[model samples]
Target: MEIKIDDLTGKEIIELIGEHLQGMSLNSPPESIHALDLDNLKKTEITFWSVWEEGQLAGCGALKELNKKHGELKSMRTSSNHLRKGVARKLLHHIIEEAKQRGYLTISLETGSMEAFMPARKLYESFEFRYCKPFADYQEDPNSVFMEKELSHFYME
Candidate 1:
C-alpha cells in the first residue's frame, strides 16, 4: 500500500471521511463523537494521509500536533472494503514514526468506549498505548476511552 499526504479534496477520501463520521454517530452519542469533519482535518495543525493500493483508496488517518512535545492521533479509518487487512496497522505505524521524526515525546488518542470500538482499542493496545485520563481539550466522559504512548527517542553518539 502507498500512503501519501492527503489534501482532503478527492472524492474517495471525502466519501471515506463521511462514512467514518456516520459510523461514529451510529456507535456513540452525538456528544461523544470526536471525529473531525473535512474542514477541521484540513487545519494547519493536522497532517492527513491516505493509503492507496493498486490505485484505490484503502484507508486514511491523521496526526494533530498538540504542541512541540506532544501529538494526537485522529480519524483513523480503514475503508469498508479493506477492513481487517492491516491498513489501520500500517497507517498507525506510519503516524507514530512521523511523530518521532517530529520530535514529539508522546502521542495520544481518544476513541469510543463502545463495543464497536473494541478492535481499535486492541490495535492501540498492541502498539503499547495505555489508558489515560483526558488530555488536551478533552474532558472526562463515560463514552470516551483515552490512550497515550510515550515515544522513546534514541540518541546517536
Candidate 2:
C-alpha cells in the first residue's frame, strides 16, 4: 500500500469520509461523535493521509499537532473492501512514525466505546496504546473511550 499526504479533494476520499461519518452516526449519538468534517480536517494543525493500493483508495488517517510534545490521531478509517487487508495497520504505522519525526512524545486518540468499535480498540491495543482518561480538549464521556501511546524517540521497532 502506498500512503501519501491527502488534500481532501478527491472523489474517492470524500466518499470514504462520508461513509465514515455515516457509520459513526449509525453507531453513536450526535453529541458523542467527535469525528471531524472535511473542513475541520483541513486545518493547519492537522496532517491528513490517504492510503492507496493499486490506485484505489484503501484507507485514511490523520495526525493533529496538539502541542510541541503531543499529537492526536483522527479520522482513521479503512475502506469496506479493504477491511482485514492491513490497510489501517500500515496507515497507523505511518502516522506514528510521522508523529515521532515531528518530535511528539505522546500520541492520543478518541474512539467509540460501543461494541461496534471493538475491532478498532483492539487494533490500538496491539500497537501498545493504553486506555486513558480524556486528553487535550476532550472530556469524559460514556460513549467515548480514550487511548494514548508514548513514543520513544530512541526505540526502534
Candidate 3:
C-alpha cells in the first residue's frame, strides 16, 4: 500500500473519515470523543494521510502539531474490509517517521478506555506508547485513555 499526504478532498477519504467518526460515537459518549471532523482535519496544524492499495482507500491517520517539539495523533482508522491487513501499522510508522523528521520531541494520543479500544491500545503499546496524564486541552476523564511516546528513540536508532 502507498501512503499519501492527504488533502482530505476525495470522496473516499471523506466517507472513510465519516465512518471513523461514527465508530467513535458508538464506542464513546459525545463529550468524551476527541476525534476530529473533516473540517477540523483540514486545519493548518494537522497533517493528514491516506493509505491506498490499487487506488482504494485502505486507511488514514493524522498528526496535529501542538508545538515545535510536541504533537498529538488524531483520526486513525482502517477501512472495515482492510482490518488486520497492517494498514494502521503502516500509517502509524509513516506518521512517526514524519514526526521524527519534523523534530517533534513527543507525540501523544487519546483513545477510548472501553473494551472496544483494546486493539488500538495494543497497537500503541507495540509502538512503545505508555499511558500518560491528559495533555493539551484535555482534562481527566474516565472514559478516555491517554498515551504518549517520545520520538528521540527513533532518532537514536
How many clashes in each candidate? 0, 0, 0
Q: How big is the positional error of residue 99 in model 1, measured in Å on the Cα after superposition?
A: 0.2
Mark the regions of model 3 whose C-alpha exceeds 4 Å error after superposition: 153-157
TM-score (C-alpha, index-matched) for candidate 3: 0.96
User: How does model 1 fare in lDDT?
Assistant: 0.98
Query: What is residue 12's positional error in candidate 1, in angstroms?
Result: 0.1
Q: Clash pairs of candidate 1?
A: none
lDDT of each: 0.98, 0.96, 0.95
Whichever of 1 and 2 has more TM-score, that candidate is 1
Cα lDDT tens digits, model 3, 1-157, are: 9999999999999999999999999999999999999999999999999999888999999999999999999999999989999999989999998998899999999999999999999999999999999999999999999999998844344
TM per prediction: 0.99, 0.97, 0.96
Model 2 misplaced regions, further than 4 Å: 155-157
- Full-model lDDT, candidate 2: 0.96
lDDT of 1 by residue, 53-86 (tens): 9998999999999999999999999999999889
Q: After TM-score superposition, what is the CA distance of residue 37 in candidate 3 from its true location, in Å?
A: 0.6
In candidate 3, the residue pairs with backbone N, CA or C atoms under 3 Å apart (3 or more residues apart, or in different chains) clash, namely: none
Residue 40 of model 1 has an lDDT of: 100
Better of 1 and 3 by lDDT: 1
Comparing 1 with 3 on TM-score, the higher-scoring candidate is: 1
